[model samples]
Target: MAKVLMKGNEAIGEAAIRAGCLNYFAYPITPQSEVAEYLAKRMPEVNGVFLQGESEVAVGYMIFGAAACGERVMTTSSSPGISLMSEAISYISGARCPAVFVNIMRGGPGLGGILPSQGDYLQATKGGGHGDYKMLVMAPDGVQEAVEMTMLAFPLAEKYRNPVMILGDGLIGQMMEPVEFPNNLNKEPTNKDHWATNGMDTRKSKEKNIVKSLFLDPKVLNDHNLTLKSQYEKMKKQEIRFEAYNTDSDYQILIVSYGTMSRVCKTVIDNLKIQGIEVGMIRPKTLFPFPEKAVYDAACKKSCKKVVSIEMNMGQMLEDIERCVKGKKEVSWYGKCGGDVPTPEEIINHIKLLLK
Candidate 1:
């Protein structure tokens, strides 16, 4: 694997191709336009399809169409554009279509700004569209994870028959970092003629496989919900992933963060540690299949006192931290939104206040 300097957005597009995704469709959006441009050049070289849809809404439906054909497909866009595609995204979730949606988030409530912001943390984690469903959200800190996690996403999406979101902030999308490409994708997407609305084939399921999230009867909905709950439980066991830094050093303060903010938090950890202040970090890679057990274990440690829930949003995941370690540990939140970035020194100052 040879390392090459690449932006996170470009890495994701290339990784999708490397991961055997031949169908690409998306509308242009700031901070993520590189993804479309990258695929435009790369897909043609490989005889793959690259379509610039008329709108984000059209692109999402195109994803549905390709997934229905049992094809490995993907799309990329930023905040408000994603909002426009919510209806289709909900449809994709309901259909249980196996596809990848890359969201390089920008500031938003509505056309907020084009700077880095993990403002969509709640939206991505909670099935950004609608209905009672969840998306497998994979957050990447740098270009390497941007590619690796995307490669991981296709298989994971197929394994669970769920749509996966590669959630990144503008910093991750625009910042250049060294990344190593896979020599070969080495795997083909599983044949999904079973339920795929693709033409009836020998591998089709005996009954009409209706991909749906609707159950009219209360009992049916309950059973479906129970099944979904079971899936979440399994994800917690199989997919709860995070990185621990300086955690084993008996730190009294723990910084819980994800995406770009976590990188800033890391610098703060170094500053605090040098000043003889005990601080640690728990950076989550998968936000939905949260690392609740890790937080619980940290809370049980007498050395751990307070947990800081930091993100680029107005404390959405903060509620999640409270649920994970409430009563057992005091949880606090510090963040900015609409494209505002927090400096490492500021994070250190915040930690200093906590340590007081």
Candidate 2:
């Protein structure tokens, strides 16, 4: 239970091990390669399995295989790597397999850059893969948070019988911070017996539990889709998390951000307040079931004049921000892409422009 200074990627691996995820398969990519490297060494010490697969595409199926056997499994990748794994992610979702994926995103639409960027926001929340399936996405702001969320992912995935993602930008994956892994993170992972494809010899019944995404019958597929939809609605109600900073008082501008960008916005809000500029911030901790109602309430404050979303991409999260505010207020976006980041002063200047 001692706190140690560690990079984000390494911490994620350690947390997963502590959370009883003994199988990890991933391909190394910038900003998150440390996760695999760390696991490669540590997994053996704990009697776990760690494999650097041929590629992200291969790793995705490796994860699916372990998960279908009812074992806790995970994989990590950067944006481009995640793109390759999307097809398998979709299949895993359709099969209702419990697997964890960590995306330490870099700049991308293609192989953009190795530096930090929030360019994968849309891909993480809006489904990078095809079909009507949705993964529970958790966005963390710092290395310590990254550790905690990584541990939480396994339980959530098992609870819903679905895939879960820990979404962080490159900054979070590469930065160093002090973190402590919780001792009570379900070290003895949940049982997945009822639906798991354990061998016939291990099950009570001789009938096999087939794990496949194929549904040829229209009626059966519709029922399956409806079940998925119902779970999503339950997640929205039970899992929405956001941090409200300086939102209790009147403010001139409301800033919405997540992950590393929200950390920078916090500094801007503090500095702006010193100069008699009042600003409040809403930092969403969950991106999928976004804190829409929280955002709408903050944006509708009597003294709130403008809304802005500052990101490290060409404003992917702005789409959700706009949806939350509706047409009552126009949502403005300020962004830098291709691994370019915004400074606190730059964000303060944007706030000034919004005020004018």
Candidate 3:
């Protein structure tokens, strides 16, 4: 199939359709409203459900209800809206329902600007809601990757029976690119016979499945938490994903980044190479099961002098990089938040100062 020119948000909606996701519930917000707009028009044609909830909070539960019945459901929102939905996210996590949510991040702390920013790193990767739960966070650097990852989220969610999050910024949500949907993304809706509460027809029917987060027994709750932890550990071993650029040969500096900021870092590296300054990069695709070992190995390269992290927020991923490198190399950061993105020239200047 020929690639089609598409905005990131619209492409994601189409990807969900191709992936056999038949139910979508969301509220409109800037930088990501196009996803809801696109799905609203397309879902009816495909006989899928596309509902615009009264609020993000309401949408979150709507996702949970549909997913509990074993539906391939999804929702999209920006920063403040995501914050509002965190409570339901926590419930979904505790209940172990399979759902996919996308966050086209904007500057935040409290209703920050609606421009591109990676300010939700901590919120998405770390525990955003009130519990000991983690999301499978995938960060895509471009529109095409966003489409691919959004398509992948459904299968991954079903495979693990957990919520998966696609983490991108306003830039990715708004940018246009040529993308081709996969030919084999047509998956049947998952069977919920074992765990879904779709109702029983006869006495021979199996026991009704109960979906809830409440556990009055301390020991049972502890066991549940441990079970979730085991799933996370398994994902860390089996699902860690990243891409290395200009890393084959030795380089003077190692740059760590993700999402749209990583694209800018690539330009900086290419321009610096023209000037005879060698640099390399590691772009992480999965944020929760972070490619920690990859970052450590790249930073430990013999010719690599120092490690630098460039982000659109105030150094959120820096902590993860530091944890990965384990102080073997000095780690530094450069960032611009509140709707402003650093230019390639600005990033190169930071690299020069670090080299000095």
Candidate 4:
């Protein structure tokens, strides 16, 4: 309704409520506890439900229940909590329940740290849970995108009848920014009623609707996978979103990164420009859809020599980088792990080393 200065984590929680999500379930985790705190107080005032479950395990099951009942439900947690929730997130996907999830990632192989990191990029994009499922992962670089994408996530999840993820770093979650709500949330695509468990009586009398991922027979499983693959093709065509910075230059190096790291890379590019070193970046906004073509295009360019994929993890995104580039151009990676963010100066140094 009105623009406000908000922290990314708290704003994401508030934006979800404003976007008509009344049910939330979560177990608090550091760097994102503000999300839980904001909603615990706000949900009751809006006549909504905010339950602090026993653990992330319980909270995830709570999400499964509410979403199954046709409620717009969501949950927020950091990496380890999300890891605990993955079992339920898998079940939620099997039921084909459209829901929203926010992973304000902290670095970790396990209990690594509480600071900002992009280590979970692959986990978010690829199948993190059991079975063949895809979550529409939206990587937000700043607090504004965090707020806006949190609101956008629900409709997008509803549109595809799939889970949607708001993948942000702890820094992005803690930073402050100005944000505005969409003019009308209902302006989104109309797909909520078809698969949702709204009513049974309104449908055809003889037909029954079942949402599940189980297909025991080999042929049946093959067919089901085909159907999912078709849906992924549509996403590749229609929903591949990315941002390019300084990409038009005759750059010798293209920096491949996303989320807050990509925002930092933007500044690195500016500094490189001052030093007469042309560099560019391809920031994948939808990590699943991946903007693979964009990655290929950049590396295929004659002016671009190599791509340096920067991430908080050692080399999580570099796998995708290898996939896209496929030897068209060289791809190298540099990073800091366990909740350490790479500074612009450090990134520039990495770029210089790559050049050398």
Candidate 5:
């Protein structure tokens, strides 16, 4: 397929459509509002439903309602907007509804700046909402990857009967890059009628499908949670995705990063290679499954003495890196939050200091 230059947020909106998602409900916020802007006009052309909710909180439940009916549904928002949607996200997870959420992260604890940040790593990978639930999280480094991940999120969500999150930074939302909509990604959703509350008559089944998150019975709720747990375990085993760069060489240090931050690290690694300072990096594509084994193996390399977690946040992913390394190698964090994305030169300097 021929690639067309497009803004990241717009590409994400189109990608969802290409993936056969027909329902989009979201509230506008910085860095990701363009997704809603693009989808609003496009959804009508495709005979899809596009409605902007009063708030992110309302949008979250809107997604839950569509998803419960087994309709392909998605929403996009920034960090603070996602926070508002957390309760509904938790409810969707508990109900075992399939849905997709794209988070174009902006800086924040509360209404921070509107610049790119990786501060929401924990919220997406760990549980953003309450209870024992995991959203399959994918972090894309560039616009093309963002398009691909967004397209893939739908099937993955339906496969696991859980929410899937496409975690990108502001750069990913604002930047323009050449992207192609894969023809194969647009496939009909399957087996939804069996479980979805679409309608008994429509499905030609007498069984009434109940879509809900509230389980009052203690044993039933526990069993429901266990089922969710098993799905997460299956994802860990089968869906971990990552890119290992410059790993063949015997490197002195390993850098673990994701999203836009990892792109800077990649550039730094290449530049360092010219100076004969070999640095390897593992760029995680799936944040939730987290590429744990890949990180552990890379850190344990006899030639690698240190592992550094490079991110746009104040070391949010640092804890995960530390756990993966398991004390075999020292793990440290280098980051700048609130929209101050570290440059490649800055990353290089940090590595040089580490080597010294």
Candidate 6:
């Protein structure tokens, strides 16, 4: 396959189309608005549906409706936009409808800035909305990985009959890089006759398919929640993904990071290695089913004395890192949330300080 140079957001839109997802309903937001812009033009050429909803809230429901009808659907938004869509996301999860959401995170507590930040890590992994719900969250470090994750998200969502999220910082959306859409990822939408409300006549089933999230009876609701819990547990057993860097060596410090932050840590590790300071890193690909065992084992290495959680947020992933380390090694955090990414030099300085 010939690689093409493209913006991360544009690559994501093209990836989705290649995956056979024709229905895209979204509202434009910074750093990710290019996805909407690109798809708006390309969708028509492919005879796909590209509708810009009045708001993210409306877009969320549009996805839910399409998914309930067993159509491949997706939406993209930034931090505040995703917040408005959280309620519908919850409903989609409870109803067991397969859908995809892309969050190109911007700085925030509330509409902070248009710059890149990993502030939405907690919201994506932990529940953004009310209730015991989780999305299969994937974080991409670069444009090419972003394309692959967006294509993979569709099948994963359908496999589990739940929403899947592509969590990228604004940098991942704005940066241009060479990317190739894998031909293997081009696939037909899965069969949804078991639950989709497409139509009895369409599926040739006598029973009517009704999609819903409202469970009035207490025991029934409890059972539904338990079912969701089982799926999440299954994910933990089968879907945890991560990348280890320089762990083969006897490293003095282990760094746990993801997305764009991990890229910086990689550079830091290489520069430190040149100076006789061995620093290792673990980059998580899946956020919800976090690579807990990877972190735990790396931290337990005898050569590793300190562990640090580096992110673009105010240590949102720190709690999870500490949990995985389990007091075996000292765990700390270093980060910036004002849209300024920590430079490799800054990280090396921090590591040196920790060692001293």
Deviation of model 5 at 200, angstroms: 1.2
Residue 212 error for model 3, in Å?
A: 0.5
lDDT tens digits by residue: candidate 5, 1-356: 79899999999999999989999999999989899999999999999999999999999999999998888999999999999999999999998888999999999999999999999999998888999999999999999999899988998998999999999999999999998888866467656875589876788677888988889999999999999999999999999999999999999999999988988898899999999999999999999998999999999999999999999998889999999999999999998996989999998999999988
Count of residue pairs whose backbone atoms collide, per candidate = 0, 0, 0, 0, 0, 0
Quick one: how many clashes does candidate 2 have? 0
lDDT of each: 0.85, 0.90, 0.92, 0.85, 0.92, 0.94
**Better candidate by lDDT, 3 or 4:** 3
- The residue-by-residue lDDT of candidate 1 on 1-356, one tens digit each, is 78889999899988999999999999999999999999999999998999999999899899988887778999999999888878888887767778888899999888999998988888888766767777788899889999999999988877766788889999999999999997766457775764377554554566666666677899987887677667667777899788988889889888888888888888888887888998878888999898888877776678988988888989988888888896798899998886878888878888888877
lDDT of 1 at 47: 88
Superposition error at 59 for model 1 (Å): 1.2
The alpha-carbon deviation from the true structure for residue 111 of candidate 6, after best TM-score superposition, in angstroms, is: 0.9
Model 6 Cα shift for residue 338 (angstroms): 0.7
What TM value does model 6 have? 0.98
Worst 10 residues of 4 by lDDT: 187-196
Instruction: Provide the TM-score for each candidate, comma-separated.
Output: 0.95, 0.97, 0.97, 0.95, 0.98, 0.98
Worst 10-residue lDDT window, candidate 5: 186-195
Per-residue lDDT over 90-199 for candidate 3, one digit per residue giving the tens place of the 0 to 100 score: 99999988899999999888988889999999999996899999999999999999999999999788777789999999999999999998897657655456446677
**Better candidate number, 5 or 6, judged by lDDT:** 6
**Residue pairs in clash, model 6:** none
- Locate the minimum summed-lDDT window of 10 residues in model 1: 194-203
Model 6 agreement with the true structure over 64-147: per-residue lDDT tens digits: 999998888999999999999999999999999999999999999898999999999999999899889999999999999999
Candidate that would win on lDDT: 6
| Alpha-carbon runs more than 4 Å astray in model 3 | 201-205
Whole-model lDDT for model 2 versus the true structure?
0.90
Whole-model lDDT, candidate 4?
0.85
